[model samples]
Target: MNKQAPQNSVRLPERMRHLAVDSRGYPVIATINRSPEKVDFGSISERRKLALGTFDWCAVCGMPFADELRWQMVFEEGALPAALSGEAPVHEVCALYAAQVCPFLFSPRSRLSDEGRKGEVRESVVRFVGFESTSAVIPHASELQPGIHTLAFEQRGHADEFSYSSPDELGERFADALAREKPLPVSDAEAVLVRLFNRLDDEGEGDVVTGAALAAGAVFAKDIFKVQGLGAFQGKSYPTAAALLLKGTEEQILKFSHDSQDEAFSAIGPWVLERAGRFPLALQRWRTRGNSMVKNLGPSSPQGPGRSVAKNAPCPCGSKRKARRCHPAGVQATP
Candidate 1:
């Protein structure tokens, strides 16, 4: 008998990056970005693409990850060796910025950029923050390209983040792992969170959402989008929040707070064709459009839009004879 695939299909690859491994090679460090389309860490040369190395600058702040600092990862089950390279390594502050305002950060199953597949009701996402283990080392690579691409590392003891109850606690322990590392001050972290929250609020400016609700969402996105994929909006959780943020569904949330994100996706239809999903359908629709270029260029126009037969035809205005016979020569004779 042949072996079967697991009960739940892996919709997204488990991208385990070793960007945080130290120079001495003790622990391995890594993190996962939610959607593959959102994964743009590898656009530069290997030297500039510091996220691929064991030590690199923070993607957001452009500072080093520091000696023995703990970082966060959101992941699911996959072979450890096959863990793919992930997004650019970011500062905890920057990651904190992203965690807020991102609906998909909270819900691992949520598709951040792909609105067509926002909450498809599959794929379990687990979140954790941890430090590199002491066993991490540089892995052999045949061709080292830049930014963030998947590579293999031989690090052990990183999965310990799972044992902890909260990522914050793990971060503290990660601080302990650093040589002479002072744990990131809680006040600093709190300050970062507050700054990120203000930014989210600023982003929601002209939307239909209420001011109070929007502010609440800023906190919720900061606190919750990283953990659960949803924060409260119109009495709903992950799905509603995702719909509002990604699909611009403020009205939809008020109309159907009880429905799931999958239902909303199905209902949104052609509005999403160009934005996400079924590109063939969008192309086919374009090809078969009622008033197309061919229709516009010819004289047999059902609607008055395109360029119809011009200067040479007999005037439809009923002077009857062809343009050359009737009036102006070589001018685009009126039909």
Candidate 2:
């Protein structure tokens, strides 16, 4: 491992700042090994790979994933059948930083140090596929060695391909991609807004709120807050303003979920009253329901073990049912 302090040339993402640095001054990802004597960036740790499923940790920062959507980099020929990926899930920022700094990703001609690894030396493309959930973990079919596991996503989201000659150029491309996101259809946006508001009304100013509604509301409020000053939905009615907010929110959710679901959930009332210009009664209902909802959801926890494990595959917990029906009902297996 590199004893020298990390180079300041690359501004790593906040989550990656605490990672172990290699001799090249690059922060080693959680899936890579960093011992006292050496930092092996070429190989992934099997123990950590398993932990990805067991603990629902990000592959890059090794932290538990929260409300943010899961992301994974896919090379030209690296995608597996049924939307499964050998690479573990990571945060969007982590994936973007890795693409900017990793030689194999940013430099098209750069080859992996280990030629024996899967998809070695092929033309590289920084393609990030997003997902709503980490669906499953099964033995890696592509790995010659045993005990290697692969992760699967339940539902894939929008994907973008980035091409650039330099890291700065790549950053520009990322920004451009976000800017190019098409607005959600007006009808769809109105429906989402009306539905959420109606749910809040139906629940009344009481202390209880549904989990699904709370989750959706948090996502809605957060996205609306983000696009607030972007010069959208100005001088509109409460329903129209909220619908426009939903439109912007849907666009954002299509890209990635909120970073803090709790914060977003809490902000619903403030956003409605201040931004959407809603009445006091609406704000009161939001506060009452949002507060109760947060208490019920508790603090954010690991999103897995997912409920999409293959019925014919061995349980992730090392069980061997005859028909491999250990996860028949998609219940979490003990890790």
Clashes of each: 19, 0
Looking at candidate 2, what is the lDDT of residue 200? 17
User: lDDT of each prediction vs. the true structure?
Assistant: 0.30, 0.44
Q: Please, what is the TM-score per model?
A: 0.26, 0.44
TM-score of 1: 0.26
**Which candidate's lDDT is highest?**
2
lDDT minimum window of 10 residues, candidate 2: 200-209
Q: What does candidate 2's lDDT look like per residue over 105-193, in tens digits?
A: 65666665653564566364456676665655443333543432232323255443344444566666445434443322223322333
Candidate 1 lDDT (Cα, 0 to 1): 0.30
- At residue 311, give the lDDT of candidate 1: 53
lDDT of 1 at 304: 18
* Candidate maximizing TM-score: 2
Tens-digit per-residue lDDT, 72-92, candidate 1: 453545423222233334444
